[model samples]
Target: MRGKNVLITGGARGIGFGIAKAVAQMGGNIVCLDSLPEPVEEFKELPQRFGVKTHYFRTDVTKESSLYKSFKDAVDTVGDLHGCLTAAGVALDKPFQEHTWEESRRILEVNCIGTFFSVQLAAKQMEKQGTGGSIVTIASIAAQGNTCPGQRLSIYNMSKGAVKAFVGPLAVELAPQKIRVNSISPGITRTPMTAALAIQYPNLVKMFDRVPPLGRMGSPEDIANAAVFLLSDASPYVTGADWLVDGGLHAGTSRSLKDPSEQ
Candidate 1:
């Protein structure tokens, strides 16, 4: 990935930050767009630490104009992009009945609509450059539907499901341009987003932990590792695919090895 320019949304923290770190370490120039305020010191020091250029812009994903301007600025600052990670998204964990229409709209706007436009904007840049590139969308294990009974996130699940489905057709369309589109469906990962809630309700976190067959929760690095692979040249022949980075959580949560004597 050396000399490559990669753009990441929601890159100020959590899974996005993890991905940014991995890309920078791999010698890729990074441009991060997020709704949060700039972390000036943190982003400015990235280049010195990883020996790669890093830039961060505050942009709201729900607003197309803001996102578009940010995209343009990123290109102007970093040159043509080699890869894009659409990690900007929102989550709603309330029960179906408790969710209001506004919540539904907000989640979809950030998680689905935001990704849709981000991919389009990034693809256009890649096409204009006449260079094949990679696009990775961040989906979630909840997209698989009812994966964990302990929590409720109907809107979030629906939004992510839509994102996961969006990749296949988009990949097919972009193939002619030598551009690849893919998605990563991550399970419950430890991040700032979930930390406060976890501390407030440790029992809920413990319940979710039991759902992963791996006997542990995931980390941002776990997802970032997979994102790097999909973005690298190693996956040139792979596209329109969904990589489930869930620690086998999608394989029914309640399972045990069969007794050899019974066999």
Candidate 2:
């Protein structure tokens, strides 16, 4: 990926930041876009820190106008995009009965619609370039299983599920152009986001402690490495594939006596 220009959405920090910086350290030029203020300011240091060209764009991925402008800006800054990693998403953790209609739409609009815009806008730009590229969407293990009690996870799960569902058709559609479409479904990773949650609820930690086969939570680097793989030619033969890096969370937990769920 040396000298290859790539756009990373929600990339100012966390998993997005890790991937962007990792790629940069590998000699790839980065265009990191996120709506958050602090990350944009903080990420400015990446280029000098890693000795790669890195640009920052503040963008609301859910808004079409903002997305178009942000894409153009990223392309203008980095020369043109050879790849994109869409990591922007929102989480709604309220109980199902507690969620309001508007609340669900807002979350889905940000998570699912933002993902759509992220991929759709990138594809249009990639087509105009008439060159193939790679697009990686960041999903979660929650897409695969029921976790977190009292969580109004319907829309979050739905949005993530849609992201996984989208890869196949997109890959088939873009293969003629040599553009790759893939996804990374990560388990819980210790990021600033999850760190806050973990502090708030200790039982959740114990649940992950005993449930997951790996006996530990994931890290941002784990997910970032997978993102790098999906973005790099190392995965040249890969497309429309979903890679799960969740510390064995999806596999049923080991329980011999009474089923854990029943217990």
Candidate 3:
């Protein structure tokens, strides 16, 4: 990732920030776009801390107009856009029956629609530069997990499925132009957005012990590393693929362990 100019949506915090920092450490410039002003203000120090150029632009991922402005701002400043990490998104955890019309719409508008618009804008910018680029998204294990009957996350799960469908064809459509599109599906990760929510468990560590063979939740760095690979030349032949960084959670999604007596 050295000498690369990268832009990440929803990069103010969480996995986006982690990705930003990771790339910065590797001698890559970073431009982050988000709806919140605080993230931009706080991210101002990343340049000094990571010894790489870093900038933050405020953009609402849900709105094309706002996203356009934000992306344009990044282009003007960064000079060359090599890739995009469209990780900006919103999560709605609600019962399907309790999901108000507004809530459902808002989730899709940001999580799915937001990703689509960002990818289009980034692809166009990269095409104009003709430098060939990588576009990665922060997807979820939910897309594949819904086959089981554990969690009731219908909207989030469905949207991720949509993200895969949305990114694959574009990967083909943009292949001729040299732009690679990919997604990373992460399981539970330790980020601010998930901190409080995951804390609901009395014994968080103990509870997580029941998770995959890894026996714990993931970290933003785990997903960030995958983002870097998808964005870097290392994965030049990898496009339209949803890379799973779920600590083997997907590999052992269901349990078939029988009682000790039966064994």
* Best-fitting candidate, scored by lDDT: 1
Query: What lDDT tens digits, residue by residue, belong to model 1 across residues 14-102?
Result: 89988998888888889999998975346677899989998888999989899999999999998889999998887766668999988
Which ranges in model 2 have alpha carbons more than 4 Å from their true place?
A: 40-42, 148-152, 254-263
Candidate 2 lDDT, tens digit per residue, 132-184?
89999987887775663333577788888888888889999999888999999
Better of 1 and 2 by TM-score: 1
Residue 42 accuracy (lDDT) in model 2? 49
Q: What TM-scores do the predictions have?
A: 0.94, 0.91, 0.90
lDDT of candidates 1 onward, in order = 0.88, 0.80, 0.80
Residues 82-179, model 3: lDDT tens digits: 98998887776556798887888888998899998888889899999988899998888887744222345678788888887777888899999999
Supply the TM-score for candidate 3: 0.90
Roughly what TM-score does model 2 have, to 2 decimal places? Answer: 0.91
Clash totals in order: 0, 0, 1
